[model samples]
Target: MVDADQTFVIVGGGLAGAKAAETLRAEGFNGRVILIGDEREHPYERPPLSKGYLLGKEERDSVFVHEAAWYAQHDVELHRGQTVTAIDRGARTVRLGDGTLIAYDKLLLATGAEPRRLDIPGTDLAGVHHLRRLAHSERLRHELKQLGRDNGHLVIAGAGWIGLEVASAARGYGAEVTIVEADPTPLHRVLGPELGQLFADLHTDHGVRFHFGARLTEIVGQDGMVLAVRTDDGEEHPAHAVLIAIGAAPRTALAENSGLALVDRADGGGVAVDESLRTSDPDIYAAGDIAAVHHPLFHTRLRVEHWANALNGGPAAARAMLGQRVSYDRVPYFFTDQYDLGMEYSGWAPPGSYDQVVVRGDTGKREFIAFWLKEGRVLAGMNVNVWDVTEPIQNLIRARTAVDTEALADPSVPLESLT
Candidate 1:
């Protein structure tokens, strides 16, 4: 049942692609493995780019998934600084930008996502930045340091995770930070008004200014350098540097060109995949940010763009490719570290999905576990400064059983006992 001649080609050299290759070897797949990526650096994790690395708490080497020699020793043919221009599904081959064609028996797409660009005028001006890649982080670190030394002002558009994290880092460097968000509260779409205000308060207490209910209209520049930013509210803030942290869009050009099915943009655009992470084309699979997987547990197609998904989804896809029975039902999880407040969120409860939010512990002290419950059933949970409760929290979501509201909000009630 095994063939050494079979070759598996993986497009994208991020954490998902790298882990898939590692899983293939660990699962005893003797077939040839070829990995292709456009970036010059070896495959690395993206979290550090915005977290430890940007904050100068982590070295450049710590971001990489494996040492440079690991791929060579593992017999994984890595193509760095190379792009897969097109996929010829009929011929089962992929064409590289250099015009090289490589055949494959099975193909995996882990192309990840790119930062959304600001469409306003003066985007090309110097000091206007977007943080999505390692190069961008490195450049932003230098800019933040310079801004800190001169007490320059940083104008950030969009109060999403990236925007808030960058603001925290800037504040750590003693730089002036002002965030302009169109939404009424920070992380409005994700956490809703109840908890979103918590984040807004946290930043305000740290000397960061917030311009809510406003959208950046244009980046005013002088001599091809950013001077200030004008918001839709007709307010112009002097800024030495500007950051656009709107969000990220999945890289689905290759999948689209190859005729792979894609999820609608409104429903969170991505490569449509089944529970096993298999694409419409039987020979092709998708994982990570690009895979909008039909989750058996949630009973809906969900595309999660988080570090945990890539860390686990890649190996799951790899096992599925090896003809192993697989079902990807991992609960959506993500965490954030901003200033002294660190938090972890498990499960999905997008606005309107939950009826009530119950909190345990002390919100005033910034140590609490907030649960989103629908009809007394836990849909999601977020622990701020609370540790060792992830398993119990995820278990509650998986159980899908109604819980007593008073008991749920009581700190003396152990989560494990409730589960």
Candidate 2:
């Protein structure tokens, strides 16, 4: 068992790692805590990278999880821009990029996911960007300002959350925007056809163009700068800048090299962990985007990438490190903001897991709560442009009682009374 006198090492200084270090101090652990990250900045939040930060409404300091002085006061060593090269599980040590070796009694691997890069030609062009870090957002912001001056077009490669959010931000800057997606509708896999159509319509109403069932074949460039994006059908869309938002893959290369077991990529790949976030090797734990956790609530192994999972997974891993028996059973939750719509969703039901969707408000008006039911049991619920209904929606999911579809669809019936 890890005690107060031993060193606890945390890899990847993102939200999950920072929160775990904070939890250790809050739980009365007086030992050394080292948080290592490859980036040159303190641990910060990523959701704002595409929203307020990219839009210039949020300042750089506001995105940080904690102030720089907080680490010093808490006695946690902040090692920025340092990469962990290897993990020696037998020796309980990690080797840094600069050949420094650090020993730890307990280690937490929070190495977060990386944005999936486009492999087509011209990916190395000057105006092509991927949104994952603060630096990426800063570059995109500068590019957007330049496009605003020229009234140029900004082409987004995918219609996912990042793609649509950036489209909204670019449109706000008075730039022509277009989104290309292979799916029939935006967010179709997660929200299904009917709801995905709503998002597609929302973007269209805001002056953003969409090309559905389109796949990028190559990015055309001139003098090492992006000029246009060419699709598979030999169609070229003019682009002053191109943002790739093709989703992300788990950062599991470090764990794999260290001989930790990982689930197959098809099965939500990452460092496989049980309910308490303990990896195959008991002394090490993983959380955030890098953990393929066995969720007790879903009864399936899944890896979540949203803000809520990282916020909750950090503290749970800390408790397990302290030799406390803990189970991670929190319902998976996430939210998205696009155009004039704001939504919060709770519970989990993968694509094809539910048979019916019951909506309480108006889908055409974009104000409603949609519930995905499997055999009358509420599997998931989402509130779009609706406020203060999250608890009631969550309670209905937790009750796991079969709900009547007609009652669920009736706007007069309160959601809390469903079960």
Candidate 3:
């Protein structure tokens, strides 16, 4: 239980930080609750940046985690647009960018992840965009609208979720788009070749050109404005705008500077935390994208960058901080939307860990429930264009039950029956 006089400080203003602040209040931590963020805006969700928000279907107000007045009403101090520069573990305080020190009885670091930047020439040119924050997406959205009706070509580097989603949006805006990826198949590292191929085919059907197994050597530009992207094979693809969406890296500088244990960079660098979300210092906890937590089910330490983990991990960390019996054991989950296809996936299995995939429904028709299994036990499940079955799919993975392959691939056999 938290003492009445203790102050709880939450660093980072992203989803995880905001959720942790809410959890602390909900759990009756009445002491000073300060939520600090480097950005001017309050906590907001990021999924819509590449989808509805970019397309102007969603308003700016909808992205915020809470209204401006909510914080004042809840007695939570809102410190925005200020950076937390250092952590003094012995003093139990953090120094802000402006050199103001704030004491804390407990600290939660949810610094989140930042987009990995491209180091190629012409990257600093105008019209070259990277979508991680609302500002980036807003700029890209405006440029896409200005380049209306196939008037300009948009060249995108990397074929990950952000790249593919941006491709879908660009196509919707009637812009000619081309994607450059070093991998032969996009998303192959995460979804495996077969399923990854499905996404490649999906984009191909919608008239999006792909340069597979090709590396981007330079961004060709004129007068500080992007004109095209040049690949290693000497192929120059024309473009008026460019987006770099390779991936993201965790913001672990605060953890590293404070001498906190961090996971190896090769294995996804982030602050290391146990199943309880506690760092080397028990009073400090790391959650969300900044936490490399041990997953009990997979028997491995994994860092997840999805919204689900941030949403659930916050409360779990708060409860654990309060000395409650808790464990952050929720299965890893994520989803993506492209064109007319939507998918929801549960469970986390590294590539080559699963022996086989048993798929139900029809892949050709773009509707299916694919289950990845190892030693006849379900490890992960994904439902594509299939509704009302996510719970059952997740249940199948959580139970870790040995399943009949035939029944798993049969449309008539309910997934719940397997568990």
Candidate 4:
């Protein structure tokens, strides 16, 4: 049933779009593949933008999904620096920013997410930054290096993953850092207070300052350059630069304009898709950060913005577009590396979902695995400085069976046995 003349168009050139195109060829589909992206750079993974690449541990080329020649050799029509302005679902064609229209037999909207901008004034000042794109990382890297050499100070507006990671990187470069958050602790929404304190302590030990229970009200600047930031608590901190790491918002404008079904903002806004990653329009599909998939295993709609989701979701969407059945039920997974601590989290455990948290190893030594359990069933797991346990951890979550609390908290007990 693979039609050689059929054309498949992919909008967005991030990991999801690039991998989908790769999967199409790998799955023996010789159809026309057209990929469009606004960014001039080739498709690349995003994790490095906050981790290795920002810290100067990775080369620029290492972040790319594929070599520059790979697309040409694979017969993929790569359209870098091109934006798909409008998607006409009825016409089965997409209008580019330059007024070009491309027809497609099947379409995939992998058009990821964008960083949420600070609503306060002085955000347009020259020393204010956001870390979402490779260009942003590159500029920040240079700024951090210069600041490190001059003993400059960086004021971060949020204590989220991006903020903490950038704070770690800035500290590594010997730049002074101060993070301000409205929550009581860092990662309050994701890890909760029980483990959020651990990250706060880790960063504090590395000389990173924390201003909790407050939010940035304005960025004070002079001559279009940031000089300091003022908190709602009437506190002003001297800053050579400011980073807005609040969060990201899914780019769902094109989908909305095309009348595609979207999840309500209250339930985590995104393009609504079934387990197959197919949208309300059968010929159109959504993937990556933009797709709020109705997970078959969890029996709920979930939108994962991490790199793992994009990595696997792309290929799954590709297979589904090829007339193959695909149920994307991969557990939500993400990792972080800050200072000397590295950790991986698996599964979903939002605030009211879990009743208790259990730890398997030593917390004082910064080596432990925390499990959130609801009614004795594992809802999520996080291993800090723990190795080679993702498989068993994911298996435990997938099983959805009640696990003994004592055994779950015992390091000597094998996790595989519990599952």
Candidate 5:
């Protein structure tokens, strides 16, 4: 139960913030809760915007997380187009962009991630875009709409989830998309070789071009608009536009300015938070991609950009915000639907962490699953078309169940048979 006067202020109204607000109300908190989002429109689902929303299958209104009426009825103070300038934890006040201060007892930072940009010359050209926000999606939708040709060239930088999804959307939008990845295979880190190859084939079957081992030297534009991309191999392509979907780093400026401790990395600097999702400051908590949480499953601190993590982790932060002690130990599940292939993956397979991998399905039909096991225990698994097996395998991984190497290689034996 929440005290009537206690005000909970959540900064950044994305999936994490919106879900936190709704989850708080569902958890029986009737206190004054204010949700501040910089977006002009109400909170919307981002996953579809990269897939169905861009393909004209889903409408903007159909993808909204919640309507204004729903939020009003639940007693949430929804502030759109509002920016949080600074956080004064000592005073328990947050400064807005319009020079107003809002006081709160508990504060949640869902500051999300920003798109990784390319520093090439013609990157700022007209046709170069990054799929980060809803506005960006709308712009891309309009651009794809304008192209009268069925196979317009759209060059992408990375083959990560966003990059591939955008490629799929663009392909569905009647544009011929080409992915330029520095890595050998798509999703090399997460999906490993076998599963990533399946994804590559899936995209290739849809008439997508893969430029593996391609390094972009310059974004060559013509007449004030993107025209071509020059690679390190001294080759220029007839490109209509460039979509830089490399990846994203956590939005940690707020945490850094507040003198909150951060999970330092040699590569990416992410927010450092304790087990309760509380930041260095006890009164404040962090969630979503921004929060670098210590995971019990991986035995390490991690920052996940997965939709499931945002939907689940934000509510866990809300619970901790309400002074309820509960450990958030949900094993992360990630999924992506590209063309006819559906992919689902769970658990952590750090870079080169798995020595030997086991495959249980055939890659010929592209309808199989593979698992990454370390020392006879399952660490991670990826399903290409057979996603129904993720549940039983996820449980086996969760339970830390060990299996015989031959049994793992056997497809006839159900994954649950080992139990």
Candidate 6:
């Protein structure tokens, strides 16, 4: 057993940091482990924040992954409501939001990303919001609670995941929401053109208006309250509130300032990491949204920002820290709930990768599984309403199984047959 005095410091107590602490303890790491986070709340699952939690179907406590007693039992030190201000790589010390320094034997930076803000005029207005933290979701819930009597409109600035989820939440509150995307579709980068169009239709079915091919000119407001939004399409939309969910960039100032090597990605920007989730510095490891992980299947370094990523990557990183020599090799899984049904998508269905998509049910029927075929094998699959196939499809994709599309698309064929 490692010395109890040996300290393992984990920065950022989100899913990644919290999971790392749990794994270290489970691995018989009796050493002192500390988890630091900017948020005061115990580490909670974030996926429900937009769906069930924001929609008033779930309470705040339900979002929490573990309670206070769990951490107490595990002997994990969770320092919430604090920030990590700086890092001294030369001495292996981390500085907190306050002027305090802590030495560490191993440092794991699960420093998450912050939602990018729109730099238009009047963006500082009061009703303008972004969904990234629990506090932000709480504010949204408050605003939503007032929807029936007071709320009227919600302008979503980005068509990304958070933006779409916020839009869904607003719709759930009976607010007339409009999603203004600078891109053509909400999930243009993540999903290809056709699937993006399908999601656009999904939102439209729920009375959510989409302003595609739009560039936000300014956030028109008065007296610190947002009143309207002006777009480059020469249209002004009235709104009671606005959600800025454009995108998120990895928070890497502490790492870059500490002379860590950052990898530049071509698809825009992302942080770089090696196979073991280690940064340029051997002693420091990066996980969660902040690190660009080397994908074993894709043969690329991809930055993933899903709840599944945090849930899985954090443990894989912990194993690596324990000399288990494990790499984070797994297909990504993410889900979104529209008004009536849930859409769960797995893996990166890159453009031109899928030669054909076999639909298991009618696309217009509101429940179906579509398998992405690349050279006759299932590369990825997107499902709406039917969730039972998600696991089997993921398994097939990982095993690189060649699917019989003729049988898969048949109405009588069970999803288990593909496995």
TM-score, candidate 2, is 0.98
Per-residue alpha-carbon lDDT of candidate 5 for residues 47-109, written as tens digits (9 for 90 to 100): 877888877898788878887798889999999999898988899999999999999999999
Flag clash pairs in model 4: none
What is candidate 5's local distance difference test score? 0.84
Give per-residue CA lDDT, model 3, range 373-405, as digits (tens): 999888888899999988898888888768999
Query: In order, what lDDT does every prediction score?
Result: 0.95, 0.90, 0.90, 0.95, 0.84, 0.82
Clashing pairs in 5: none
Per-model TM-score, in order, reads 0.99, 0.98, 0.98, 0.99, 0.96, 0.94
The predicted structure with the larger lDDT, 5 or 6, is: 5
Deviation from native of the Cα of residue 275 in model 4, angstroms = 0.2
Which is the winner by TM-score between candidate 3 and candidate 5? 3
Q: How would you encode candidate 2's per-residue C-alpha lDDT over 1-419 as one tens digit per residue?
A: 35578999999999999999999988888889999999999999898999998988999899999999999999999999999999999999999999999999889999999999888998899999999998999999999988878999999988988999999889888889999999999988778886788899999999999998988989999989888999997789999889999898989989999999999988878899999999999899999999999987677898989888888898889888888898988878888888789999888876799999888889989999999999999999999999998888888888888998999999898887887
Off by over 4 Å in 3: none
- Cα lDDT of model 1 by residue, 141-249, tens digit: 9999999999999999999999999999999988999999999999999999999999999999999999999989999999998999999989999999999999999
Candidate 2: segments with Cα more than 4 A from true spot: none
Candidate 6 TM-score, true structure as reference: 0.94
The sequence of per-residue lDDT tens digits that candidate 4 reaches over residues 1-419 is 68999999999999999999999999999989999999999999999999999999999999999999999999999999998999888889999999999999999999999999888989999989999999999999999998999999999999999999999999999999999999999999999999999999999999999999999999999988889999999999999999999999999999999999999988989999999999999999999999999998788999999999999999999999999999999999999999989999999998888999999999999999999999999989999999899999999999999999999999999999998
**Residue 387 of model 6: what lDDT?**
65
Q: Taking the tens digit of each residue's C-alpha lDDT, what string does model 6 give over 1-419?
A: 66677888899888988898889988989888889988879998888778888888988899887887888788888888888888898898998878889899888989888888777898788888888888888898888666545758898888887888777778777888899987788788777776677778888988899998997889888877888999998999998788888788888888888888776746534557788888788878888988888788767777888888888878777777777787777887888887776888887767776788787887786788877778878778788898677777788688676778899888687767777
Q: What ranking emerges by lDDT with the best candidate at the front?
A: 4, 1, 2, 3, 5, 6
Please give the RMSD to the true structure for each candidate, in Å. Answer: 0.7, 1.1, 1.0, 0.7, 1.6, 1.9
| Candidate 2 weakest lDDT stretch, 10 residues | 1-10
Q: Model 4 — TM-score against the truth? A: 0.99
